[model samples]
Target: MDVIGTSGLTKRFGRVTAVDHVDLRVPAGARFGLLGPNGSGKTTLVRMLLGLVHPTSGSVELLGRAMPRHGAEVLPRVGALVEGPSAWPHLSGPANLRLLDAAGPGGRRRDRRRRVQDALERVGLGGIDRRPVRAYSLGMRQRLGIAAALLRAPELLLLDEPTNGLDPRGIGEVRDLLIALNEAGTTVVLSSHLLTEVEALCTRVGVMDGGQLVLTEDLDVLRAPTGHVLVRTPDPAAVVPLLDGQVVGRSGDALVVRGDDAAALNARLVAAGVAVSELALQRRTLEQVVLGLTGTGSDRVDGGTT
Candidate 1:
């Protein structure tokens, strides 16, 4: 089931088209990655999805219901942390979440404490005290924002640059939490410029370029193994002749042999008395695929827009 669907979802600011006539779809229970360079309309598109920004022309559906039209009903089932998490600088993480929960629908006063605690713990901030968010580090604030989004335990999570300002450990914690949530049947729609994060966490991917939805495919399909194998051997001289016409490219002790199966290539090399130190299927990297499809981030001019 598709949790999000959009048709001709265009957003414009005067003469500038921030988001073109783009169509986007995200399936349920998927770790969907929304990738784009800066000024590619990723954030604008996310705002439209949450009904925070109305589109110039287009339609949106969330959980199979028309968005904005049914936002009151649909939004409660969705959790969002956009443009990074925001909180009152004077309030502690728990207090910030408490106020937000109190303001939003579906938060029970009786359960608010437990809910806040759980959200914080999930984000690795359960030990926080009355220290104002202003005293917190950038990484702590980011985690606090995520905790706020998780307070409702919504069926869907829409996070943008979620791990921004996070250390390597914090990043890993967020990734693991998202994976756990997806495993438990909550669909995740992540908007991030971090290509590596998307490559690591997403099952499906959507690429945006110049406000257009340029590509959308399963991660496996986008990164399908090319019909080549990479072999790293100390004896490159000996292995090259065995692969002969099959060798496409090489660098020092590394060889790119044109073949689909690694096992077969390894067998052939071993049979030819070559010491196979390392051999594996060569596939298009996420970076290679993205770089090929997208221009430099600065190339996109959104007319002073983000």
Candidate 2:
């Protein structure tokens, strides 16, 4: 079953439309990445999914149940982190989590401590000190937020910019943890503008631009071989004419040729005395795919000065 589904979902605020008509589906056991830059509507869409924001038009179904109407029954099975993690400055990490768990549904009082500890451990705070939240670093606070989301051992996780405050190692650790959870049958949905993060962690991706969902596909399919080969040789000029129009692109000593077969391209280069040094099939990078499909991200601003 699709853990999350939306049909023509849209949200408007006065004169501004934060989320346009968007149809999204996240299948069970998928590491689905919701990708878009700031103001691209990713956050709005996520809020609607969790029933925190009412859509201006269209429908939403989460865990096979309608949102808001059935949110009482469905939200407990799902976990989420939006905007950022928030906690009382004077409270310890464990204390903050305990309070959140107690207030939320789907967690029993008897199991609260175990749940908090497991969640903290899952998020790499297994041995943390008894410091108040005000003393925690930005990364530590981010992890604490993630732990709160996992307190219920939810079946679905909706995380926005999950790696925002993390260092390289922390990012990798989080990525590994998400993968492990997905393997264990958890459907993880990560919403971020970081292309590299999504590429490394997600199996499926959906892109938003100008509040519209412009693309949705499996990561592998979007990165399918372009039927081209990337060749890097000391002598690129000599091989270009031999392959004629097959050489679609070149940079310095490198050439992109529509050879389809890497072996054939290598053999041909060898026969032509091209002195090949490197050769490989060229596949589209996630950045390339997203850039081609979307315009300038919303982060950039322009004003008339002339």
Model 1 per-residue lDDT tens digits across residues 1-306: 899999999999999999999999898899999998888999999999999999999999999999889999998889999997788998888899999999898778999999999999999998998999999999999999899889898999999999999999999999999999999989999999899999999999999999999999999998899998899999998876676689889899999999898998888888888898899887898888888898665744575532
- The count of residue-pair clashes in candidate 1 stands at 0
In candidate 1 the C-alpha lDDT for residue 58 amounts to: 97
lDDT of each: 0.91, 0.92
Residue-pair clashes per prediction, in order, are: 0, 0
Clashes of 2: 0
Distance (Å) between predicted and true CA of 158, model 1? 0.3
Query: Stretches of candidate 1 above 4 Å error?
Result: 299-306
List candidate 2 stretches off by more than 4 Å: 271-273, 301-306
